[model samples]
Target: MANTRSSLKRARQNVKRNTRNKIIRSNTKSTVRNIVDLVKTKAQDALDPQKIYSAYLL
Candidate 1:
């Protein structure tokens, strides 16, 4: 158990940040996989440089 106020506050902040980071990282992975699959299908649109694919930015 955290005996001090600061310790407890830090623990709460850590939990919140970890959850946020995990969600962002997972979404990035899923987006990349989807893009890769689209590329494998030989979709010319997927290869276009003009298209703004969020996965590419990640």
Candidate 2:
């Protein structure tokens, strides 16, 4: 449906960017879920500060 060459190129770029974004979003959600599970299954005293810090950085 793109009438111009530039528009066709832009459409392709959008598709590529969309797929890349979806992968990044999924990975971020998985990392957060893992961090939450780690905190939930462990006692406060047993939680590792380093792990918490790293998760926060992510």
Candidate 3:
């Protein structure tokens, strides 16, 4: 092939990885935050944790 790939390839890989990690991290954070909010506000988020867990599955 031509001299392998360009530096952009590595950069793109990093971008993809960062995006994936960011999304997952955000999800986990929001999950925990939802739990915290429920406890702090003393209100039911979904009547049970099962609802949150099921939502995370998607």
Candidate 4:
């Protein structure tokens, strides 16, 4: 429990940052998983730089 005003505000900020980080982490993991699946299913596209770049960027 946060008793002080500053501590309470800090706690709230931590919660918000945690949720934002989780969202970013989830997106990154899913993007990697998608890239792996693409490589396994289509060897040709995997070699193409543009395809991989697009996958990670978008």
Best by TM-score: 4
Give the alpha carbon lDDT tens digit for every residue of 1-58 in model 1: 5569999889999999999999999999999999999788667766767654765787
User: What is residue 13's positional error in candidate 1, in angstroms?
Assistant: 0.4
| Per-residue lDDT of candidate 3, residues 1-58 (tens digit) | 6445786788889999999999999999999999998796655656568877998899
A best-first ranking of the candidates according to their TM-score comes to: 4, 2, 1, 3
lDDT of 2 at 36: 93
Q: For each candidate, give its TM-score against the true structure.
A: 0.66, 0.66, 0.52, 0.67
25 Cα displacement, candidate 1 (Å): 0.9
TM-score of 2: 0.66
Models ranked on lDDT: 4, 2, 1, 3
Residue range 1-58, candidate 2, lDDT tens digits: 6469999889999999999999999999999999998888786645879878888899
TM-score, model 3 to reference = 0.52
Q: Per-residue lDDT for 51 in model 1? A: 59
What are the per-model numbers of colliding residue pairs? 0, 0, 0, 0
Which stretch of 10 consecutive residues in model 3 shows the poorest summed lDDT?
40-49
- Predicted structure 1: lDDT: 0.86
Name the candidate that leads on lDDT. Answer: 4
